[model samples]
Target: TNDPLVVFTPSGKRGRFAVGTPILTAARQLGVDLDSVCGGRGICSKCQITPSYGEFSKHGVTVQGGALSEWNSVEQRYQDKRGLKEGRRLGCQAAVQGDVVIDVPPESQVHKQVVRKRAEARDIVLDPSTRLYYVEVAEPDMHDPSGDLERLRDALKDQWEIENVTADLHILQTMQPILRKGAWKVTVAVHLGDGENRPRIMNIWPGYYEGTVYGLAVDLGSTTIAAHLCDLQTGEVLASSGVMNPQIRFGEDLMSRVSYSMMNAKGADEMTRAVREGMCGLFTQIAVEAGIDKELIVDAVFVCNPVMHHLLLGIDPFELGQAPFALATNNALRLRADDLALNIHPSARIYMLPCIAGHVGADAAAVALSEAPDKSDDLVLVVDVGTNAEILLGNRDKVLACSSPTGPAFEGAQISSGQRAAPGAIERVEIDPVSKAPRFKVIGSDLWSDEEGFDEVIATSGVTGICGSGIIEMVAEMRMHGIVDAPGLIGSPEQTGSDRCFLDGRTYSYRVYDGAAAGGPLITITNRDIREIQMAKAALYSGARLLMDKFGVDKVDRVVLAGAFGAHISTKHAMVLGMIPDAPLDRVTSAGNAAGTGARIALLNTAARGEIEATVRAIHKIETAIEPRFQEHFVNASAIPNAVEPFPILNS
Candidate 1:
């Protein structure tokens, strides 16, 4: 008989398996990480998979109910003991019998999981571009013989002192109904304009909107899209939510997406629709959570890197792929939400912060505004670590910015078993120097695998692959434990005098966790994994060094890690890994989602938009790709804490 064809949804990875082939084995062959703490013995019960037995048109796979084998004694025993949820089966015990489609939920996969979304606490003065006006328009008199729109405009000008306000064609079509329904007393949503432009009426509602008017401040990250629903009146963030970028299905990183666009004719358009749809979903979610109509969000501010910015605006990012990477436009954009296909008020204005350069984009400008590196007397270095690390350094007198290609290693890409920071992922690790015994903690659980009562805690989610932060700490801990050397070579048993270190073909591997006996897969750190981390960190550190050299400063007084990944990373581990320059531990801190906060500030204060625009223009951009010294810096930075540059603060 022909082998069974198994397909995994969302990722669209598929493989053919022989009769009785375990689902876990299929996932492994397809490079999908499913949590399995007990190898394939089914004791750990971590390799749980949900098989969807129906036509999955999106994935082009139809799974029959009898495609997989029945529950074996091992799975049944574990289920009786631990109480497995209905419709969930152990991937290790449930073998493939025919064509099947498996849905690896967030809890099952290491790379995909619930993203963290928390608004950064900051203060901003309210000066929103959107304002609501409740006006009582004069009844149209046959004697006066004035048009309804003209009468409405006269009322807005007379009552609210809003001058020269105009309505769009769509607004005009629905204007009469709203005015008549409100009995000539309606509320109008006005989008305030700058000194150069005239204010325009966005939305018209029957009667007064008793609820608060809202605006969305969005940080369109390559990996995650976070949004904050702010009260336009008070500038307070009423609700916050985030979702993984739907474009992740197309490509995991920005450059990959750009490449996809280059390869496919409609790639850019497809990605644009995916993200806009995701934003619309988020808008609906925030509105429901805040108990307001989605139309109440009359204004929005968006900040993203150059690629995401282009994709969101439906601009083809093909030019961004080559040297002298050109941006479609570096200027701050003011467009209609409808033009971008965002499901907000039809006439709502969308403000995008200015892009700093070809690589450094509006997100960088937002970060600069949030941190205000130029406002400080002391030299300040602000680093946003993502697939591309954006570096800003300087004081009030001079500010320098640069973009470094760190790849996606820092975000859990490029590693053999790497994943995004998510529940069930191994987030923290420790190894005993003597025995080389490893103990670690997953994201959802508080207890380490070796700690007491960990068995009950681990039952929630089994040990998955290492995430970004976990990968960093694991490599740093390996270096500290003498499992790996300065040049990033894993030590052999003969070299380290420990059995935990062993040879894997031509290279050596360090055993991080031995779970075979417990039915979990053996987790090991290969020499290649170390090199990937080194390359990523080296690029980041080299970029910072280039800026420091240009700024004529050997050391910065303060360092701000500005991003979600930065927020969770350990400063000590970062220093040990040479991901950043040396600084006093306390002096280095994360500026949790500073770009998102900056978007919020711009959403609330129109002046802030101008302030960031001016700041970005004043910032001198250093192109690391063109810099000759970047190679030298990267070579030195490849070693832990740098091979040449003395990290006196970190050494102490």
Candidate 2:
């Protein structure tokens, strides 16, 4: 046996590494970057390679047939040719005892976001919230019993009626010295109070950090992260750019991550480091791309789910994984950029919006800001569908929110073939209401319009797999055509994977193959896959229904959908799956990435910190697992979105 494992790519990319080096690490040393989220705990089934006949440890689990364990989380080959988990292996955990050749999945990446584009900021405007101001005070004369600092404080209290006049150590360090240098001129970043005594100072850009105080807003999602460089002088979004979330390294769904975090005391640290590193990298990239100094990022607003928030802060998420799931901190947290190890300006202030519960996080709070729930009386339902789905139901008087364990179904997970919103991912699809043929548009190409030669178009270019949005569309189409039963059971010949099946030894079924990938079919949606969808959709539906029942509201007046997928997927498709309530077209609104928007809000406005804290305290949490009825509701919700009624129009 070789002391060190040896692996090579088909194209002669080969290298040897210490025996202790995992396949992914070995691959990297050998110039191969493998994709293994969960920090390579051996899940996701993304990194898989076949051993060069006889080169693998007979005892070591193989990702190929006739050599590995019976249970491969990703592929079936682990057990026998009769059962292969798609030849999947976690590159990070799977150590090579011998030489092997591996193939990287198209979904694989060295980092989550390939391009981190920065946006140009809009003009700054000062609101009642706060601002970065430079002031010059008169030198203390003989009659001035009050010091220069006192004089400055008096002017602030007298002119703006501000109460809190605190100074940082850095600010005070130069306060006495600078009192004479610029004739007592200083720039202070003050966070204005919201009619309460929540006064604070975010920063003091010494030497007249001239011009409007610049800040950023960030909406961090489970799968994607977006940033908005804003001018604090004006509350407008200066520039905005978004990319996939880097936390995906852990898992695709919230529970999976929560489970992963329960490993040990160090789990939280690992999770937090992964997120911080990802964010820090993005911040540096965006700042550099925007042609701005990182120091200019003085303040930022952050909003995300409770798990995501915890992960970003390096807090343990294990508590949220079990019964009576609770949040680490529902109230808003204000931390210096350096504390969380975010690579923004050292003095930069980052405020995380308050969480409604362990599930409904600052994203909901941000959306609530838009709704101004405090002023409304009608029943409003705010549904944010991400890896973790948060649903808020109530009126001005009382509100109830519960986050369901809806995995990446809506974002294209658990489906036969699902993925985040990216190039080659199918964004839209239209089935011939007549022939039942499907015409879809791949995100990278604007070819859905090539209606006449759809097959030729796919053949010429390349069609990989149906994305989450496309899957929803196709499922909706199947339901309409009676090809799929209401409960998602494949119908007859034209039903299910029948006509399109492939030869899987004994059973032959419809095979899903993109033009580019014909060697092996990716998603052969089995009856089990259909059941998973049924369970997911049902959970979403029953959860919404139960919330409405609790609030004593018949139906929601308005439903706001949040998150990357929620904003983009067709509402009609969502309704078909019963993922959302069947409301009027106008009743449902798609607010693009409310979490990301809220993050940006915190980044730009320091005053928002207190407001978010108050918001967290104000909102109520609904524990879904409290009642046994929830299980029944979930089981019922597992059917198609809307059984047989007219589906709501999903207008963009």
Candidate 3:
């Protein structure tokens, strides 16, 4: 009988195995590293794999049911005792029954992903909505016959000076027991509502609960979701964690995800569940890191593009796929954590930043709030570069914002040998002008590939592939070294006078790095890769140019790159590649996940919610699709440093 095929992702290893062969056996045969400390006995449970069931058109695989065998006795017993994660199976016990795509989570693999997201350090004043009030109520007197609840209400009013405080319906059921336990002296956790709304008691704890109140701030990016656990009282970030947006398997970019929702009957619901589950995982992680109970997270603030904003709320994004891009709602939202199925306090509140437009969603609003481009005296340009680049330009007088479809090239989706920012992924690159040779640094190691003792490091974790930042630097360096011309064409060996330049078949290519081991693939930059970068950069520059034209400014005084990818990219390369308008290099800096930071601000300070809400309303929204000059600007910006616009600063 023919054997079943099993493919492992992040390593891209594939193998064929007979029936009853364990997944760990297949992985080992293919040289894929999966942790198995107990020698396939299923005791450690470290070798767990998630079998992706469905059609993955991009990878040309269709995963069917029974691809992996039913849970064995060992796996079942382990799960019963130490709960296995959803969709995960013990790789040693689960046998291959048919073709399948297995995802070895970063934690389960011997090699792990190097998470790069960090909480941007900023001081914020504490004005959290959740407040602790210590109250002393008169014990229920049989002589007076005043009810326990009524007397407690009166005491709350007299002691805390809070009026119209109502308890949640669940709180009422256990009120008597909690009152008796506290001996009428209890600390009530009150959650203040929006303007004109009554304050409500969220939790009533016996005695003074001296622990710190916690809140979560989340930036739900199209590619990644990051979370920060903060002390609601001190406005201090206690822990930060991030996970790859699980929706990537469904589709790579925003429009693709929207398209997936359009094509698949239950696509929207599936994506929603995936992200919520991912968020739940992050919540558990941050809570453990902070040494706090999961229920203590009483509040959360989120920011994401409109698509993510809609999907997270279970809204269909079908209309967003068409013209006019209708949004179900653009106003800031407040919903119960349980409504969204988030793992937090039962009565916790979730606040979402307002969406600026159909394309420019709450993430852009969060960027505007964190950067405050509208408050600047000089012309300020803020670009939150990602799959979709959101541009904000203006000063105190006027602000203009637009969204450009830059695609996933910048995030390493379209490029050959491209991968997400993992441990072995190349993140930094430098090209020597003299020899036209390149050296690079991977995420986990500090030393460059050309430096001493680099071979040992590369031996441990092989050079994986180029990431977003490395792509930017590679193209910019190619252009600077005259290996690429003004028309975005890679030069031949005769023209560049470098052996590194050669023609692969019809088009020219440059060797970036030789393989670390024999027969390993050489990292090469093809002409097609450069074109992908050009198209991505052109879209970004054109969007910024359109915003600048709306602002009636020739050049921006400063440029702020906002996002994780933006923070990692070199400012000089961004300018050289015409990804942003010309500005002094010193004035160009990263805002460092501005959306996440803005979410944190809103979580700690309620006033910020109102401030950004007003700011988004006052700002003008320009639709790039409707603009006529967008195409012309895009064509001109496709060239390095732009063909039409003069970058005198960079030229000097």
lDDT of each: 0.84, 0.61, 0.84
Rank by TM-score (best first): 3, 1, 2
Which of 2 and 3 is ahead in lDDT? 3
Model 2: CA > 4 A from native: 1-129, 140-164, 173-187, 193-210, 242-246, 449-461, 494-525, 600-618, 642-652
Q: Tell me the alpha-carbon RMSD of every candidate.
A: 24.3, 26.5, 22.8
Supply the TM-score for candidate 3: 0.80
lDDT per residue for candidate 2 within 343-421, as digits (tens), equals 7766566667777776677788876654444446777777777555677776668767777767666666666666656
Per the 3 Å backbone cut-off, how many clashing residue pairs does candidate 2 have? 42
Worst 10 residues of 3 by lDDT: 112-121
TM-score of each: 0.79, 0.70, 0.80
Candidate 1's displacement at residue 573, Å, is: 1.0
**Model 1 RMSD, rounded to 1 decimal:** 24.3
Per residue, candidate 1 scores C-alpha lDDT tens digits across 153-247 of: 99888766678988889888999989999999777777878646579887887876545578899999987899999887656678999888999
The positional error of residue 616 in candidate 1, measured at the CA in angstroms, is: 0.8
